[model samples]
Target: MDGTWLDHSRWPSAGRVLAAVSIMPALALAGWLLAGLPLLLLGWFRPLPMLLFGGALAVALCVYGARLEREDDAADATVWHVAATCGIAAASAVFNGIFHSEQLVIRRDPATYAQYAVWLADHGSLPIPYGTAAFGGPDPALVPSSVGVYDYGGAIVPQFMPGAPIVQAIGHWLGGVSGLLLVPPVLGGLAVLTVAGVVARLVGARWAPLAALAFAVALPVLYTSRTTFSEIPSLILIFGGIALALDTRARPRAAALAGLVFGLAVLVRIDGLRDVLPVLAYAGLLIALRRRQGRGERYARMGLPLLGGLAVGVGLGFLAAYSLARPYLSYLSDSVLPLLAICAVVLAATVAGAVLGPRIIPAGWKAMRGGRAARWLPGLAAGLVVLVTLGLAARPWVQTVHRVAKAEGDVLNAKFIVMTQLANGLPPDPSRLYYENSLYWVIWYVGVPVVVLATLAAAVLARRMALGRGFVWLLPLAIIGWTTVTTLWRPAITPDHPFASRRLVPVIVPGLILLAVWGLRWMWARARQAGYGPRVQRSLLAAGGALVLLPAVVTSIGTAFSPIERGESAQVAKLCEALPRDASVLIVERVTGERFTQVVRGMCRLPVAQVRPSGEAGAAAGANADINLAAPADVTRLAGRIRSAGRSPVVLAAQQAQLAPYGPATQVVKLRTRQDERSLVDPPNGTWSLTIDVWMAVPPTS
Candidate 1:
């Protein structure tokens, strides 16, 4: 892994620096989350307590980091090492700022995540108190619910795990909405560092900048990092966990910290539980007595601490899910048991292997360990990976993936798929899941060269793992393979580019990028062995690096500089200003209620309720809704009740005519912004225009 540019031999490896710094972010996030969740469940998640607690944890992290053992030889890091890392981070942060999305309205998941964070930041509590007293108690005509918020016993409960919001709440305290929005980009830049660290450890430190540059320009990385999505932070924890696990410094603490970090990812995104499954298996593998040099104690030390940390982290996540976000858990009931069952099965199997293998199947296990079988398995494993890729690539020709639209989300996703089909000029197939085209989706952003190189690298790595080789890549390959196969198999979200691309970013995108860089390094090494001159070797490295980077840059080129959802904070501010102070807000329109119910309640500091829909009107996370609110009579009655209770009733709708019966309709929010681009059959090149207009009026007291 010789660098063609300057001699970087004396530089401290990116891996070492990563080991030193990666834990801080994860520990901070975990510290706040672990402290915040219990308080939130008990309605005590305030700013002062959280700040103090977080500060204490930050201090502890610094002390712990200072105590980590540093090898004196590679201890001195070069200025170039620090500069390249910081420069990459700076560039990524700048890119995020340029294209940062203010998805403040509750129209999609990003907006939902944003609103959830805003509420947490401002109120520091869960199950937002309904403030039913302002409207003079409960009425059948009024509902206190919004898109991703559910009503429970007169309180508003935000859907989704509290981890992401808890992390984003820091941004709110730092500044306000702008600061809140800025956190994601900063996290995104940190993500660049995390990925580079993984590459430096597994690949060469020389390749860290290349990995950083490659993923920095990747479409999914760009898209997820610019908004309040859980993917970025989860990525940091997952990759940081990987980096920590590979770190030999302060072996016990490092292993334990790595486990804790992986566990916390489950708190951020539930999919993280599935993403870390391989680690669970790896833990078991380490626990099982391998006829090796270090003996059983060596493996147990590594395994036990990791297992303990993972347990605590997972326990915290599930506790938060069941307590703070029970409705979200209910909504995902169908998959929850299966995920747990799988985890249980993996855990049980791991236990069984560790406990019983020596007594029952020693010969067979030893044979598999280093016999002819072990030598042949790598080639077979590599071939299997290629075969699997081919199978996925050719799947569309033989099968059309589909999901039964039984659940509300499934139905909406079906509709989105159909719409995306129409947009792509293909025949509308409501049932089409497009899972068969998963391989093509990978190709769309990374290009054919990356796909090919990554596959080769995966195959090579697969072969290398058989005889106790390439220990650094063992868990990474497992995590990446496990997630890639499963996500591509069943992407359960809407089958649209950029939107569906999130499924790829967490592990798959960076994992493949790391592999592609490794594959190029592998190629260079082989060329060097073949007596190729330095010039030819440099040419090979440059060409391969270009293959790894160029397509991702080209793919993200369109939206890289073009910011979507711009001016959204301004529009929300304007709308908040238009709402009269001390006014009891009654949202009569379905879409308006869905988009602004919580906005008014939380942001405008008004007691707001929406008319209970009669029939065809329901809230939407990303689905299209009709402009009509069917319960004007219900709303009028509610307004009369509000007036009698000594409160002025304000009506909100999408159009002037809708609010005409109440009073003069004044458009409060005329937000014109760009929506995230959607493409089912191809790569998304640009964004679509989104126009949201909110009309408001005050009803007569008479």
Candidate 2:
């Protein structure tokens, strides 16, 4: 790499900057109004087609806007970055709105989100519900016994975090489902932006923006932003925590901040706690290890700030738990308090190890140093023995893994396999492989290569550190890797492997920044060594960052353009919106409109009617009696029920072709999709399709 290339020329001229800034605002305005304004217009009059047009035009405008006026001034480039990032996030949100009603059933753990949203709407200020089993409390008549009271309603539940839920709750209160749909991604976007800022500050200027750009374009981040999931927010806390840890100056304050961020991470997903353990444990270990060299006071001085942070963090955790899992906070002492106690014990142990290393462990020290297994056995056993002494130390984990595996297996065997057998056993779709395939592509495209270069950069930087300090500097990496490997092997890990990137994010994020800083210094040194021009070195470094980011950016954009099932809940939304406010709701399918509607209502605050059906409405029996009801019937039977009621009850029909038994009156509403648009693509053939059909009869007054 040419050394002179690394140095940037003076800012491309003020005229260029002014022109760039001017063009950006216009591009931004166009992008912002493209979908938003039309949707607003649709609300006033021409809704359906306007919404469709707005969406199509918005996508086009955004694609156009991103390409206009390309120059890379850090400040101006940052503006473009902000615009492009926002545009993609908004596009995902719009897609969410259009397709929300299609799924009929909540995907993944969105049910938990629904439960919390409903709790928030019913109560004021979050995570403050009574009893267990989500909104409306536990039903003794329905369940033999409460399996275990979980305060999923409060702060501890990631979905109901202070920032995310408060926003969604407002949305739920103001506009209902529409508000909820918009809320998650906005929070995700903010978190993403915050993470980007932290990343840029930690890494060199060149790498920071590019790293942020890669994340902005990444599919997983985009997907997380669009859905009511906590992954992105967890990402924010993890990165923030790591960045704080890397700051050498203000050690105590940084540690405290890191603790607070890690605490928030735990609130997002109980599993998220695993991500921060390496940093926290390693910091303590380092302090303890250094204590024998008469650095105990210095380590204590550094660790004191974190003590305040720990208190604040635990308080925040308790607050989060109380807010999200309010109904079950009392019982949280079992699940949460123990972990707090254990962490405290570890902190104390670290302090003790630091203060009394030689005196307290003289016997073990001799044995460990001598490699005498028998003499060292008690210390090792003592550590294990202490761990085991904690009540239910290992059983809870075993039980949880067993329960999840068994539940998933039974469902797959019974519902998937047996049902397929009854239906002539359809072959599995190949297209489904694309999900994991996309992930693999991204890992290779971005993660591995970045990691390799980063390691090289780290090695170069390590040469700058004095010998002892160099090894100590690398300690964080070892600790982080060990924690990551342990976490990945956990049985309950996310099935999405590339999501492992998110798991390693705390390390990767700060690590990259540190790498860039090192790489910059290394480039300077290399330039000096080769006697190359500073300008060339700077340019090469900048180019190096581009090399790392471009493939990721290109791959992500390419993946986004791939044909996917559009509007995951499109038909479901239509069904709900089409239904009269008074129409009784019935979901005959296992987890159809009834569950979706509950989530929708919980999310949106719409007063829908729930009703009981004529036959066994097994799956949706617990839906609201008037609007959230599930009516199980044949097409004719359903028609007869509608006729007998002498009014249309809102019906959501899935696999509408099966209702051929009913006469022509069983009209299914469908959007006329335009196939002529070259840019627009449909899901490739052989993909399993789920479509929702919303049906309503003509009002008598009309």
**TM-score of candidate 1 relative to the true fold:** 0.93
True-vs-predicted CA distance for residue 63, candidate 2, Å? 37
Candidate 1 per-residue lDDT, tens place, 558-638, comes to 878878888889988998898778789988888889898888877777899888766543344124544356455677778
For model 2, how does the per-residue alpha-carbon lDDT over 1-702 read when each residue is reduced to its tens digit? 767665656335322232233222222222222333223223321234434653455455334423332242223334455555445435545543443321113433443454454445454432222322221222221111111113242312323333334334434555555565556556555544445444343343333445555555554454445545556555655554544444422344445644554555555555454455555555554455444444434333445455455445545545555544444334333444655666677667766765665455556656555766644454454343233223223333343232222433344433433333333334432111122222232244355445445556554434323222344344344434444334333323232322333443433343443454445555566777998787887787667667666655554454444323345345445554665554433333333443444443443334222223323443345553322223333323433444355444343434343222232234434532211011101111122333444333331221
Error of 2 at 494 (Å): 5.3
In model 1, the worst 10-residue window by lDDT is 69-78
Q: Each model's number of backbone clashes?
A: 0, 58
Q: After superposition, how far is residue 198 of candidate 2 from its true place, in Å?
A: 4.3
C-alpha-based local distance difference test score of model 1: 0.80
Candidate 1: residue 374 Cα off by (Å): 3.7
Best by TM-score: 1
In model 1, the Cα lDDT at residue 185 comes to: 94
